[model samples]
Target: MRRYLLQDTAQGIFFVTISNLTKEDSGKYWCAVSTKLSIGNLFDEVSLTVVDDKTLATMFISAC
Candidate 1:
């Protein structure tokens, strides 16, 4: 149940929020920006990782 939050950059740079992340949620996220000066666009991509809750807890307790 992954979700995306696209903010309105109508006023400039802003923040984006994601929710309900899962293992498959891992991927490249791009944020494109366009302005009057630039005929093209600017993109910022990030790699995300989402691990299973059960697996995470198991690893956490074992490491401790």
Candidate 2:
């Protein structure tokens, strides 16, 4: 399976896709933007949680 894919929406918007998510995939991820030599790089981080179908359903139910 394709693990990673980077896409540009043709409108200055970008997306990153990770396929076949698993428990191992749950971790911190970073999105980096490079700037000109005069400026440093920009980075944003997000935490991901990979849960099974049952767990996801339970979470949804509990939220209601």
Candidate 3:
């Protein structure tokens, strides 16, 4: 089984949180919506990249 946390609001704002993220989760994610105020559907995509602890350490070290 898989678990996910979703945060949303009355406004058109939304968020998806994945705890204990894994490399398999790295990909393009999008939110698609349709409302009475709009004649057509709208969608936006976001990129999520998950890195391993070693990669994170390397990034911080290289940035220094």
Candidate 4:
């Protein structure tokens, strides 16, 4: 699982980014803050859906 912690100083935005999305990656995700001693709790769960698509031309090309 790839996780990211990025802060945009220009926009003043705080959020996390997930990369390398896959079908199994589709699930409930959330964010939390914590210290080195202990982990934080879960809050504001969000659902993510990943769709896999193939074009007809690509499919036909591969079949050839």
RMSD of 4: 13.8
Query: Who is ahead in lDDT, 1 or 4?
Result: 1
lDDT of 1 at 43: 59
* lDDT by residue for model 4 (22-42), tens: 677677765444335454443
lDDT of each: 0.50, 0.57, 0.54, 0.44
lDDT tens readout by residue for model 1, 8-55: 544564655666566776666655666566456665665666776222
Candidate 3 structure lDDT: 0.54
Q: Which stretch of 10 consecutive residues in model 2 shows the poorest summed lDDT?
A: 55-64
Please report the candidate that would top lDDT against the real structure: 2
Models 1 onward score TM values of 0.57, 0.66, 0.64, 0.45
Q: Which ten residues in a row have the lowest lDDT in candidate 4?
A: 55-64
Could you arrange the candidates by TM-score from highest to lowest? 2, 3, 1, 4
User: What is the per-residue lDDT of model 2 for residues 1-64, given as tens digits with 9 covering 90 to 100?
Assistant: 5566777665645766666677877778776767675767866776778885212211101110
lDDT at position 59, candidate 3: 12
Q: What is the alpha-carbon lDDT of model 4 when measured against the actual structure?
A: 0.44
Pairs in clash, predicted candidate 4:
none
Order of candidate numbers by lDDT, starting with the best = 2, 3, 1, 4
Positional deviation of 4 in candidate 1, in angstroms?
Answer: 2.8
Residue pairs with backbone overlap in model 2:
none
